[model samples]
Target: MGDFNQSVVLEAIRRSGEGSSRIELAEATGLSAQTVTNITRRLLDDGLIREAGRTINGPGKPRVTLRLVPDSRFAVGVHLDPAVMTFVLLDLSGAVVRRTSAHTPDMEPRRIVEAMAATIDALITGSGVDRTSIAGVGIAAPGPLDAEKGTVIDPPKLRGWNRVPLQAVLAEATGFPVVLEKDTTAAAVGELWMRRASADDSFVFVYLGTGIGAALVREGEAVRGSTRNIGEVGHIIVDPDGPSCTCGSRGCVEVVCTPQAIVAQAAHAGVFPEDQGMSDVDAVEARLTELCDRAADGDALADGVLRQAAAHMSVLTAALTNMLDVDRVVFGGPFWSRLADVYLREIPDRLERASATRAVRSLPVDGTVVGDDVGAVGAGCVVLDSVLSPRASALLLGH
Candidate 1:
């Protein structure tokens, strides 16, 4: 199953959904008929796939359709956000079998790992699935990650999370191999899997969590850069005259596009009070929600603040689209849903105005089909992906 040929054959059947005949698989994967026969035989014997039914394709003999066994394997995906931690159990078919979420504990990194291990235990046990059927756990965490070391390198949102070796430690604590992924990249992978996009589909995933980041998808694959950490847009100066950032830059995405930044704008506009300090994540989340609600209810000041954010975000979007030349733009993360209505309404026209290819094409902007918990769902799918859909590329998993 680790072979590239095997991955091609298995992915063909998985994508077929209704099922595919051996002849269809051979043609779809460009594998020889004999090779497809041998691989399908092994897959059926191993219970990863099964003969669903027989089909008559104007043939001499009826062709047996092969389909993936959705329940044959399971995976755990965890989204480690500073505000909330989301968990999901996914089957081989990429369906969420069970899920849960909890507020993140403000503790040391090791203590948070302990909490993750415990929650993963309850998620599997409560679902009544055997432990051995579980493949591994995938952690979608905030980045500048040391992918080779499997450690997160001081994400601003997660206090005290320095160079913690998350992959090795979580594997030891849970007794399952762990994969650490940048939350944005994981969300892109999750969208790729769930969206079932065409082979030529491409987009830039704008992940709006505690921070703002981007992920690339090219030819239906997540494009993780050299260090497995691309799309670090935090310090990209979006508004030269906007607020100052920790990186000693003014109007960076971290200071202008993030929820905290939006909340700061709201407070400054007197749409909301700034009693809670700007660094408080939960308070920022609540305030952001309220600000959105106010805008929805026709509060002009609140709308004005969000529109300004959308304008700054369009600057970021134009930068990415002009440089990358993707097919479209996708928005997702824990904070994406609340911001969707305004962002959708506001970002398109501004982006169109700033687009490098506006003359050739009108760039499409849409929210993630997988919704807010996409980070967790995509993390779980990452584990499943490592198993079924292997890529012939430089993509690297964080240990």
Candidate 2:
């Protein structure tokens, strides 16, 4: 059977969870019953799926149901942030069987790649899963990188990473196919797949990390731009005359609304301890956490800074929703876990008041239920997506 038909049948069964009869599979995948049978037979032969008893719903004959064999395959997902490196080994069902994290080494490409290779080995070995069953590794990194070539192109604040061929290096070192994706887009994919969202649901995912970025998911597919570098929302101009950005622009969202920017604003407002140093990524993360904690504890200065940051972020969020005509926005990442409540409370009002379609619909802002490991989980989903998810592109090829 062709791979496209196989993927369609497999995805339909997988999405159905416990099981789906051949008839149900055909309906779900828009494939004929004979095609579904042929594909399922091939999948069964490959141990990718198995019959899970039979459904007898007052029928003349019992209908066989099919389910995915979760242990038949696995994949590794790596999230490389400026501050931390997270690794997760996921089974066919997208469950994280094993997970680990370590502080990201200094941004030397060779050192980071070597460390990642070791980490990948450790995760696979420690999981006790069949090594050969592992599909590949999916990596989510800060972007502006070339996704086509799988190279890391000069992400902000990460030194020594200029057009580094990360995918090829990791593939060579780990002996597994490697797929690279932008962190935000990977997270958005993770959300959609993990939630089993229908094709009609579309939303904008707002990612808050060392920096801010976004991903647009329309009809269950992430909009990968011509260069696959679409969601660099950080550069959206929020304030025309506020401050000069690194990109030689005035008051971009990235320059004014990132965690670093919030931390800087707090420091300037004399919120940090006199002896505290905010010179590096770790320090900035620590300070951001401290500020969030203080704000949660009702510290006036900390609350003011966070609210101010949320206000700036609202400008960007509102603009994105208005421009895209999307009604849903999701916030996630390490920093978002701390600031979720404040953002959920603040962003919706700004969105409704400023939205072009306020009279027709209300935009809802929600926090990620995937927790802090969203990027890592999403990274793993990239590998699963490549192997199992059905795509419309398959139709063009006559699959």
What is candidate 2's lDDT per residue for 1-399, written digit by digit as tens?
A: 478888888888878888899988888878898998888998999999998898887857899989999999999999999899999999998888999998898888898999999999998998899889999999999988898789989998688899999999999999999999999999998888777878788899999988789999998788878888878887798878757887899989877888877888898888985456665889889899999999999999998888888888899998899899875998998789998867877888887899999889888888876778889989899999999987878668453
Instruction: Write the residue-wise lDDT of candidate 1 on 1-399 in tens digits.
Output: 237788889888888889899999989988889999999998998899998889887849999989999999999999999988999999998999999998788848877988899999999999999899999999999998999999999888888988989999999999999999999999999998898888889999999999999999998899999999999999999999988887888989988999988998888889877686978788889899999898899999999999999899989999999999999999999988898888999999999999989999999999999989999999998999999896875244457
> Each candidate: what lDDT?
0.91, 0.88
Q: Alpha carbon lDDT of residue 367, candidate 1? A: 95
Q: Summing lDDT over every window of 10 consecutive residues in candidate 1, give the lowest-scoring window.
A: 390-399
For model 1, the local distance difference test gives 0.91
By lDDT, the best candidate is: 1
Model 1 spans with C-alpha error above 4 angstroms: 393-399
Deviation (Å) of 12 in candidate 2 = 1.4
Q: RMSD in Å for candidate 2, one decimal?
A: 1.9
Superposed by TM-score, candidate 1 places the C-alpha of residue 7 at a distance from the truth, in angstroms, of 0.6
Cα lDDT, model 2, residue 35: 91
- TM-score of candidate 2 on Cα atoms, chains taken together: 0.96
